[model samples]
Target chain A: MKFMNNVYQVITVAKKEYIDALKNRVFIIFVSFLLILTFVSIIVSSFDFQAKVISYQTALAELQASHQIIQNLTAPEFYPLQLLRGTIEYIEIIGAILAIVLGYLSIAKEKGNNTLQLLFTRPISKIKLFFGKFLGNVLLLTSVSGFMFFGIYLIISLIGKTVITNIEIEKIFLSFIFSIIYLSTFFSISALLALIFKSLSNSLILSFVIWIVFVLVIPQIGDTLDPDNQVPGGLFNKIGITQKSDQLTILKDFSSYEKARDSLEQSSFTKHYERLIFALLGIKDMYNGKTINFIINDKNSDILWLVSAMILSSTLTSIIFTKKKLINK
Target chain B: MNKIFYIAKEEIKILFREKIFFTLLGVFVVMSLISSFLGFMATNTTTSIYNSSVKFLIQKGINNIPPNPMLSFGALTDFRNIIIYMFLIGALLAVVIGHRSFIRERKSGVLPILFSRPISSNTLFFGKALGIGITIFSIILSAFLIGILSSLLLPYRHLLFDDILRLIIFYIFSFFYLLFFGFVGLLFAIKTKSESLALFIPICIWVGISFVLPEIISGQNPTALLNPIAMGQVQVQNSVFFSLMQTYLQPFSIGGQYTSFALQLINNTSQTSLINVILNNLSNITTLFISIIGTSTLCIYSINKNNIGKDEIYE
Candidate 1:
């Protein structure tokens, strides 16, 4: 009976939160940006494909005109699914920012308006309130992701004139699910910070600083440590360390550096999220055309990291929200 | 002039007091130091690699050794990472400075008080601009000082007067590039009703200018999007569509031009006189100059047009 009552309270609060978010102009703008960028990515990627094909054809024509024996002149394969590459990058940057803004606004608005005190006067426990907000946000994020995936599906099939496999659809769906978890980590952190900081603006500023560290600094640090990230191709490739065995042999010489780089990468949830999504979406050529099972199996650790981050951040948020005197600055 | 200086001084004081600004300043300094150290390490590693290779060739009785690429000024291109970091983080920092200049005043209910003062709108605008300009310059200068010190500590390469001059020029370009964004943020802050929206809109523009435009222009080559040195290495097959896009996008790509100009100075890969390199890239230089001037003019206009008492404050 108590559990049922708590659930009822949570649902009521969640519905209110959902309605408020829907009415928010900032939220609306972010969603619009995401959707618009999704379409733009598809269009831009298609043009990119066309350009590559044209360049290849031109090269082939030149070779034939000279009557030269042609080798390695195969036409580029058009992977309609590859159009999702830009979408992932957009999500990494814009989607993460949206999550941060939504999370910040959700708590900061309540705090700023002195509504938290009124809300506390209700029968709902603080945990229930926090859960309600989290659930509402999760639902909202889910809908956004659902719309994103469906739009990509429609654009790829209808506009791009390419058919996606059922399995490919499933993989895309799974990637979005992971994205939700990844994004929720940011949301939970922002919400937690909003609850902690006295000034709402300070909370928002700190959130952005944290965002820069995780989104830009940490990953780039890892990239810098790995000589491969210094150049266009992997540095190893540039230095004639091409073969897998040869690369490993050389890596052994710099195992300490590799270990340090790995640790730095491990600290960032973005790295985990990127690793999983990049594999699932075949952003890297090695993962291209691979089955979802194969990709997931290869990236099991990254998936685990992302899930752990989501769970850890949300749990921490709930605990902090319940234990802290949120109204007393 | 005295009133402007007073306002500017007060602005600087408030900026230093803000924890967010202080934190960003610290991060920028640390990043600069790290970038310079990394450049030093890269140079050292390359030198060692060349030495070992030469030793091995001598043992094999090979007489002629290829010149080490690391010995040239091109090796200083490792410091190009600093330019990339500045491009990525500079605009965001400027947004903060810009917000503090205009939006925060409105939020704190200080704008109305300022508006009632005897000072004209032009003076107020100039004062705020001057304050922001000095603050940004100081932050960059701090980073420059740290970078130079860190680089000097590493004895891998002898520091030349010419190299020091080039570094100073690069930072100057960086200052203008960052100032342009600061003015842009100020422009948006004055225009927008919502404080968060003011911040968000400028950042969105930053994203477009720094990331999206470059990505579109340099398709299939992500490195070129951030690193002008990498862009220099890219060989784009000519297409009318691409040409049109490049022409349209070039003016907006202040970050790219900054990167290119800085890399050209530090790397000197063209192996030409500095004046010739500057002359050859006159168009890029002019674009940066025009952008700074244009954005400053717009920012001033926005400040003048905005009525502190009339504007809605969305807190």
Candidate 2:
């Protein structure tokens, strides 16, 4: 009975917040941007689509010129839609910012508008009030995201485009899932901020700071912790180190070493981490079974841990903020 | 000045009183600590291992290569570049500060109370601005000091002092960018009496100016922009109008060829050479000054027109 009451109260609060948000020009602009971005992504992904085709053509030409066999050159079943994966990622980033802004504003706006005091006067529980606001914003985002998706899908379908594949749809769904997780974190941060900081702006700053650390800093720090992409010795270690006979030319030969170094230099950390993680997890066997064996167990465990931690934090933040007193600013 | 000081002091006091700031600070420090430990272990282990690998490679035949210490743990060059890009992320904080100032006061009934006093509108505006500026600066400075100290004190000793300097410079640049955004945010805060308007306007501007504008300038393609991170760069383009404005504002002769190959994919490749030449020849200081002035002027206008709770306060 209590839970239902809480839910109803939250729903009521959320309805009011949602209406307020819809009338807000900023939210409208954000939704507009998302719509535009969805279309823009269609355009951007098309470029990638073109680039990949060109790259394949160039590869074919090079192989043919060199008298090498260009075998199995058929476009993979998922070929056309692969760029959609990138589009989804771009969307997730946009979604992250949106979640932070909306969530932060939803709570902070009450105080800034001098409406929080009035809100507290309503016979609703704080939990309902807090969760209601977050869910309301989430519903709004879902609507906007759904609209964008529908619009894009319609345009593509109408155009009789061959690029929309089930695989691409799957990737888009995966991206949407990830966006939910990302958005939840931002939402929790917003609630936490709204409770902790009396001023809407300061709360926003805190939310923004949280986003920076999670999205930018931690990822970098994670990569910078891995071992495979390290620089060579400090000259002292080079003194006694001997070259092994079976080493690849790229690793051993002087000219090849420069090329290797250049290749390594140009590569992104994500790529480096992927390679190392794959090898460590023994997933390299999936690509090549012999000669290289990765012995480590539970490779995906860290990802699980990260996901769990994020969920835990979000839950804890909600619990903490829900019980806190509503200050009438 | 007194009003400014009082407001700033109040801002700082509230920051300390609030759990959010402490929570965030704790989060940052803990994250930094963990990262430092991981960086140390990863860099130390990889450097030792890679040192041997490099020796083996070189002893067999490797030549004409420069050793990049940046790869001690990972090829951190891109990661480092992203970290630099993240500095611009502080713009969000500035936006929040600016958006909240008058917007919050009005929400809390503080605006009318303050106006009831003998303070001039300019002083009121300045006080709020100064309060936000000081608060932002203090938080940023603390974060910078912590980040640099952690990097230097980390066990691996892999990070160079210069790297720390780069981080500091980036922090300072971040602060300036924050101020730039802060002023703009303040303008928006003052323009709209609505609470949602204050919160959302700055974010939308950030998304538009910092994200979408660059996207448009890059010709709707991902590859066209030379360093995507340059969007965060405080430097404005060397447009003639911008240059003229900058020349009138700052004493420094700024501007140089700004053609970065990273942006090639974003621009028409053929004109890149010419663009490079033009950018090199133009004075950058002029453009930067103009943009700052434009933002500041907008803030001034917003503050001047802001008349929230006026009748209530005067009566």
Candidate 3:
């Protein structure tokens, strides 16, 4: 009976939190932006594919007219999965910010309104209350990610005119699962910060600073450290250093710098999440058309890092909220 | 005029008292130094590699080693990252400054008192603008000084007077570019009802200007997305949309324009006066000027029309 009651209380709180999140204008705006951006990315990728197809068809037509050998004129392979590349980038940037905002609003609103005291006066324990809020947000994030995945699926199947195989659907599902985990880590961090700081604005500002550092600054630092990352298509590739081993050989000359860059990149959960998703969704050119088994096997460490980050951040948030004082005044 | 100065002085004082302000300022300074330093390191590495390759080629009896690209005026391209940083973090800092200058005052109910002091809204607006101008100027000046000091650490190259002059010119352009963003923030702060939304609107604008438009303009050309230097190397058969982006969108992209102008100045490719460069890119210059003036006018107009005492009077 007690266990059932606890579950019921958690559900009740979760529902309240979900309703509150829906009413938030900022959250609404962010969700709209995410959806719009995702849609736009799909459209843009389709246009890009169309342009390539037209050029390929034109070349093929000219070759046939000129009586050239048609053996070398292979048709362009349509990798509809490549459209997810832009979606992933948009998710990386916008999804993370949305998580932060949702996390902030979840606790900061209660604290600002002194409703935490009222909640503490309830029969439920603080641990349960915290879990309820977390559960609520998890459901909300899942819904958001699910909506995005469905949108992507519709665009790919309807617009790209591609057959959605079971394997492709599985990959999309797995990517959404990973996105939820990746975004939950940020949500946990933001919630923890909100709980720690008395002032809502301070917490929000600190969260943004941390977000900027992790999301923008760290990856940029790593890119800057490697001369190859400064240029598009890899600087070495531009200069005829096409082989991966040759690139590594050149990079080995700057081992100390590489070590620093690697360390900085490892410190950011954003990098780990990006690495895993890029591999899983075939966002990177090298990863395109790779099987799920190949991605999992090759990117095992990235998967480990992402899961670890999500666990660590969520655990920290739970502990902090349960132990910390509820009232500021 | 004296009243405006007093208001400006008070605004500056309030800005310095906030911990967030100092933290942001520190971030800007440190990031500027680090970006400039990394740029120097990247150039030095390239130069060393070039020298060693040339030596090996000469030893192999191939005497006609091509001139090292890193040793030319293009070495100044290293500082392009600083301009990029100005567009990203520098714009956010401006938003913060602009928010604190106007939005915070309105939120704290201090604006009515200030308005009651017999000062016209135009004078007050100018004062706030002047205060923000001074604060941003100081930040940029420090960045310039630190940039110069850090550049001296690059072992392979010596600073030329021409390089220094170009750097100064770039910093001047950066100041105006950042000021325009600040005014944009102020415009939103005055226009929006919610304070958080006010701040968020500016960030949305930043992302749109800095990322989205450029991505659309540089479709399929990955290099042109981030680095303006790579835009020069892109060879595309222009479609109608592409042509439209180049002609219309390119002029309004203040960040791209500033970056391109800075790159030209630092590379010394034109060897012409800054005025000539401005004339050459008249459309871009006009767009930038119009943006600055339009935003300032809107900000002043918003402040003048709105009742400063009412909290519910914003959009």
Candidate 4:
């Protein structure tokens, strides 16, 4: 009965978080803007402007999907899941900010209103209350992922005029689930900082600083470090290293340089999430047409790293929020 | 005027004491210091990879090896990544500085109290704006020096007079471009009822400016642009929609313009005089100037319109 009561408290708090985020007009507006932009970009990708601005990848997908022939472009089969590559990039950049804001507000508001102390005085223990808040965050994030899923589904069906295959749906579902994990890790980092710091503004600034480093800086460093990125089409392609075997053979001589580049990306969870999502979405050329199981098996370590980051950061957040001096102001 | 200067001086002092601001400033400096070295490394690694690829081809009995791509590269090529770093880090630091400037007074519940004094709202705005302008200038200048010093550290290269002039113009462009974001941060900070929203809205704009607009214009995946090679990929489609977008929205794509201009100035081989370069980019220069002026007007207007007596309804 006691365990059930604890679960009940967690659910109540979780529901409040979900509702609170919904009620916040700014959050709603931003979320809607993000969804609408993603959908519009996917839907109208064939028009010259959309093709030029929305992402050429989407334009390519459109050509491939509609079975239109453009010379110098050839694909044996079209992978519909690849359309969500732009969506994933949006989620990586804008979605991460949304998560950070959600995490900061999850506790910052309670402390700001001076209700945290009062809430702790109630029958529920600090640990349970903290868990409730975390649960609330989880619910809110799941709802966001749900909306993103619908937007992608709407595009594939409405635009492509083809129902998603079960396997395609499954791959997309897994991709979004990983997105939640990626976003939740950022949320935990924001919440942990908001909990630990006395100055909420300072905490928020630091969160953004961390966000820029991971989302923009590190991934970019990894890209610029790649020798293949040196030419217009690709440096390797320029030199007839079209085959993976040839590419790897050449890279073997510069193993340490390659390792350093990989290590830089590995240090940031965004890269792990991106690699996993890109593979699942078949956005990566090598991963296209590969089976879901094969892709997952190949990218399992990314899954592990992503999940571990979410768990570790969340644990740290919970521990920090329960400190003796939870809120000074 | 004396009082405004006093307010500006105090603003600078307080900004220096903020640990988060200092830490970010340090990051901007460090990134500026290493940007050229990283570019140099990118060239070295690519050349080395090319050499190995040639050797591998000879081993496979394939003899028609391509000439070295890096042969065409100038010392200016080593500074390519600075364009990206400016887009990624430089604009963001500006936003933070702007947000922190006003958010602090509002958060401390002191804005109303400041208004109660014998000071005009416009006076306060200018004071703060001047302080912010100087602060941003100082940061940009420091980054400029760091960039030059790092270039000096590049192995086996000499930066010519035009290279130095281009770097100067690039930093000048960066200062104004970043200042626009600074004003964006200030305007939202004053207008928004919630602290997080104040920050969130501006960052969303940053994302749009930095990544989204360029993606739309270039039709490249946002990530693909990070690869220096993709920077030069032309997205030329002569269609009504594409032409319309280029005509109207392209001017507002200041970040995209900045990136292209930065690459031209820093990375690409151009021997034009500084005057011609400036004249050629008159559209972008005017757009940036207009944007900064417009944003600062709105920022000051928001401050005057703000009811300083009431505490901010922060979430």
**Order by TM-score, highest first:** 4, 1, 3, 2
lDDT of model number 4: 0.81
* RMSD, one per candidate, in order: 2.9, 10.1, 3.4, 3.9
Candidate 3 local lDDT, residue A241: 47
User: Where does the lowest 10-residue lDDT sum fall in candidate 1 chain B?
Assistant: B220-229
Q: Which of candidates 3 and 4 is the stronger one according to DockQ?
A: 4
3 or 4: which has the higher lDDT?
Answer: 4
What would the per-residue lDDT of candidate 3 be over residues A161-252, giving only the tens digit for each residue?
78988888988988999999999988998999888876565576677777777877777666666665444455554444467775565556
DockQ of 1: 0.35
> Residue by residue across B76-161, what tens digits does model 4's lDDT show?
77778877877878888888888888888887888778888998878888888888889999998988887778777776866888
Tell me the lDDT of model 1 at B62: 68
RMSD of 3: 3.4
**Model 2: per-residue Cα lDDT over B5-100, one tens digit each:** 787677667655656556555654455345344545544554555555666557769664445344422221222332323334445656656665
| Candidate 2, residue B240: how far the Cα is off, in Å | 23
* Residue B49 in model 1: lDDT: 47
lDDT by residue for model 2 (A91-182), tens = 54465567776776676666555676776677876666767876787777667666666676665656536656554454344334444554
Residue ranges of candidate 2 with Cα displaced over 4 Å:
A1-21, A48-80, A101-138, A152-160, A174-178, A192-203, A223-329, B1-49, B55-89, B97-175, B213-285, B308-315
Q: Is candidate 1 or candidate 2 better by TM-score?
A: 1
Error of 3 at A227 (Å): 2.6
For candidate 3, give the DockQ: 0.31
Better of 2 and 4 by TM-score: 4
**TM-score against native, each model:** 0.92, 0.62, 0.90, 0.93
